[model samples]
Target: MLQWKEFEAWVCIEGEETVEYDVQTSEDDRTVTCWIASELGKKFSIHWKNKAFLQDVGGSVKVDGNPCGGTISYAWRDLGRTISKSGIADAATLKSFVFSSLEVTDDDDALISSSSSALQDLGLLELTIYPVRINGELESTVFSRLNLSDLKVHERSKKAVTQQIKLAEPQPLEKAPRVLDIERTGPEVVKFCFKYRPIDVLRANGIAPSPSRLKRKASAEPPRALTPDDLEELADLEEAKNLREKLRALEKKLHKRDKKPRIKDEDGDVIDLTQNGARNKRVKVESDRPFISGEVIDLT
Candidate 1:
């Protein structure tokens, strides 16, 4: 989250809070920048909140240099969102944020400057918030839909990003009223930018970790104490692991013992020649039991 005084903002993908890396804030604390991973076909949203609403505040959102809409809230408000898409007052459609891959082209002429202007701000989701005061009553106005396909350019212009915002299936949005007369109350404005790239690109740039790497999140709560039952269960599990180790060791020994060869000698005794440590190992066999010429006997 990007926070300035009581105002804060962040981006959410499919209702999930993504990991933000390389977070940097200006010395004046008015501007913040961070990196996030964007997967293709995933939907995302921008959210902002103000804890201490002492004055009327307004915000504007832009995705990939495309201005979505301006949000004007009444005094002493808490939360708001960037208008991704809008419809006429009588229509029933809303806009959603989706990550989409750019279609590459092989046009040599357009490759040089095809997407220069578009890709410059292609991966940025910026929000600007500032104090505002209005003079006239609010009027209802509809947002114009933006067609992304019409902005296609050569793939070389994509820079470090290959994906752009893709609108999902139309959803419903709350009715909004536009402020007719509004002016900034302060000279300074707070800005937050969420820069995105593909997951592999982020990992290669050391902005994100490799897949399935060991990771831990920071938690405010302390570790919980272990109960007596929990300790007992842990002890039992350890004992079981030790027993399995011992059983494996014994089985290994038995297998080695069975692999040795043994045979009876000329006398009524069993001679074991498999033992390399001993010069000649002999076992006493029953004199009454007659042994065959090639009969084998175990001395171990």
Candidate 2:
């Protein structure tokens, strides 16, 4: 039902969610990378080539990683995802992923420096937007694509779909942010380099880092509230809800009876399975449906 190609021409997303997010930032806070995932799970990363500039009230200059403060050549590429929509046969193409500009704040900066627990809060990452559109008309906001069929509309009508993404609040690493001492490539510019430690260099005597916060919490009794894992599993089951319903219908079609089964031997001798000692020397017998062969076999 999604008219992705038509919507791509005019659909523009201008939003931001604080990360423990995509739009990767370096430890030194010089280079920042931003990324967003579409509803279908396609990833688009924004590369800000230039540091954002801030002019103080006294006319002094401060350089930061905020993309909104400056203009620079930025582009994004689609990182394809494997999405399984119940009724959608073909995968949706990601036409474009664009951020209007970056919005940075002191609080965001502080969040970047705190513990990594912020990464687990999905509500903090996603927005509940209303006034959704369906074929140019505003419709109710339903989060899952499976619910789209519930909307009252003609089958021939074109469907409008919105991509959903949740950005996390970025939290800083606990250890001192390791920054390379390489010469600056340009004013306020830093290049990212991969650094790896050899296993030999690892301190065998040192304790390994603690398990993640969620893991630590999972060791205790789970809360009564539905968790993110539960919601994800539920979403998967929701996609198969129709199949389950069909299976139930088929089961209902099967003829059922509470009486004991009647078995026939090769000699056409009728045997009451419920009678005493029927299990003695009973060879494997060919079986058929009760309605098809008019043989009422009670399984009760």
Candidate 3:
């Protein structure tokens, strides 16, 4: 919601107050601007409320810089309440306000496709309020002439336009709304501007914060506390690893023992002499005779 003096305005989606971002006011506080996220094919509306004052006040609204067909006049008796421009009167019917995505195509006239009004003010909703006096004439509702196809531009000229205000299906209205004749007495006392775009576009432009996941992925999450079960499982894994290390050490020792050179004693007992010590027996043999281990021959 945006407010100045006693007037307040907001954008609505499906009758609920839509979120606004980057709300700002000029130094004088007469002009207020904000960014709003739009979803394609979603219904939306403009809403406002004013305070009770001694004099009557009125205003005009522009959706995408074109006058939206509705009157904003409030006397002392008609203040302090919220009002919404849910839809527009289209020839005795009502067309719901909608947010729609723009389609960009490769037009054959790509070389000379002129920028249309639809592209200039693609996604803005504004309200200008001022002091007014009741006149004796009647005002007419200006139906929006923004056709969805009118927004389709050449691919080369698509620029940054992604969404715009479009009308939804027209429903039957038994009677159209009444029009009031009111004239502005002075310049607009306050102005509210809402620039709307898709959520992706907003994130791209840094107007709204990126989705929570983009910032709060698990890599950034705080370390979780370990439970008793978690500690027990970790302890069991460490014990298993220690047991494997001991087994490897034992196997390595056995392997070393088997690789050592061995000899036999005269009593036919196997002996190992790979390591030398005082008690190690040295067997004398004639190199001229071919001898093999683990074999004995009988002398005739």
Per residue, candidate 2 scores C-alpha lDDT tens digits across 95-175 of 232211122233432343222322222111111111111222222221122111111222222112122222222333344
lDDT digits (tens) for residues 1-300 of candidate 3: 887777788988887787889999995768999998888888987877777554676656677656765556467566887777766675478777788766667866643234666566667887777788877654444444522334555767667767767778889989767666667788778888889888788889888888784565566678999999999999999999999999999999999878866566666666666555514575644355676796674311
**Number of the top TM-score candidate:** 3
RMSD of 2: 27.7
In angstroms, the error of model 3 at 113 is 8.6
lDDT of 1 by residue, 133-221 (tens): 87775444434444343356576666667877767777665654343567899954689889999878998988877765655656889
Alpha-carbon TM-score of each model against the true structure:
0.61, 0.15, 0.64
Worst 10 residues of 3 by lDDT: 140-149
Question: How would the candidate models be sorted by TM-score, starting from the highest?
Answer: 3, 1, 2
How many clashing pairs in candidate 1? 1
Please tell me which model should have the higher lDDT, number 1 or number 3. Answer: 3
Model 1: which ten-residue window has the lowest total lDDT?
81-90
